[model samples]
Target: ALYYYADNPQRPYDPEKAKQMLSAAGVSNLTLKYLIRAGDEVDEQTAVLVQQQLAQAGITANLQKVDPSQEWDMTIAGDYDISVNYWTNDILDPDQKTTFVLGHDSNNNYMTNYKNDAVKDLVAKARLELDPKKREQMYIDLQKMAKDDVNWIDLYYSPYINVARKNIDNFHQNPLGRFFLEDTVKN
Candidate 1:
């Protein structure tokens, strides 16, 4: 809902306002098709929550749960109206997080089909920038533009989990979610 409305974090959620907006737009009893990938409890539960929220505004969300493999293809092909899926920006660099997913020519840009010259330029410049401050500002602006554009819904944040035995030594995982197995020694 926040993503769809480009909501500001400072403002609280107002279902009545949303209902009024829908009513004003003559959107009562509107039905929208929603997609959810199979096999993930988080994704499934989130979709249901979204459905319930939209109902408050007199919108009916019909959810279709499909195989995880088919979900991407359907999104890329623009066959879905709305889809609840998970993505990981595992890399430490924001460039990897944004560019690979939101770049104009990005392979993973199927959901929004987003192509913004400013965003592309900022991402490009940020990649080559050596100054941390400059790079950080560029990424900040890029994210702000993306949110304003309502590219996608920002759902719950899930932490990455990895387990190892006590005997294991030098076990480390990069921010990119890569496991350093070569340096790991087991007693």
Candidate 2:
């Protein structure tokens, strides 16, 4: 349970509520541009699923396939209305993900451009916190705040997998999906 918090916010599926909210806001016939990276079957499938879900909520998402080569530049520059993407934390640290992706001051804010003074303050404190428990609590608080802000929506996390020969001894993949082969020996 690296980053599991018992009180984490839960997003229950409520398409009716979404429709009601849109109606209350006087929004009708709403359509959004959804960016999907081209040449990825998984991404295309995900986009289709998301499109169907949004249609259920009375919102139309116009899918646009962007070339993988230019998707990063376009997404980072806030050029799209909505983009489907994923982030992998190779470092396996909450700070590594939060600082760059969510922090307001970070250059790699992932096109959200979300600015929150409280988030910035917490990030600074967590960075300097020596106690692991306190630091974890700080991150938990940040996560709660992030959920409330709703700047980014996390769909799902996919675990990294590796295939190797049975004779490979001590070949273990770390939590971050990194392989340290130096200590591994073949049988």
What is the RMSD, in Å, between candidate 1 and the native fold over all Cα?
4.6
Alpha-carbon runs more than 4 Å astray in model 1 = 1-12, 106-110, 128-132
Tens-digit per-residue lDDT, 1-187, candidate 2? 4565668777777899999999999999999988889989999999999899999999999998989878878877777778878887767667777788678764656677877888888888888898989988888888888878886887888888888898888887787767888879888
Q: Ten-residue segment with the worst summed lDDT in candidate 2?
A: 101-110
After superposing candidate 2, which stretches have Cα over 4 Å from the reference? 1-3, 185-187
Residues 90-175 of candidate 1 have per-residue lDDT tens digits of 54556665776567764656466777778888778878988867766777777788777767766766666888889999988775
Note the residue pairs that clash in candidate 2: none
Model 2, CA-based lDDT: 0.82
lDDT of 1: 0.74
4: Cα error in model 2, Å: 3.4
TM-scores for all predictions: 0.79, 0.90
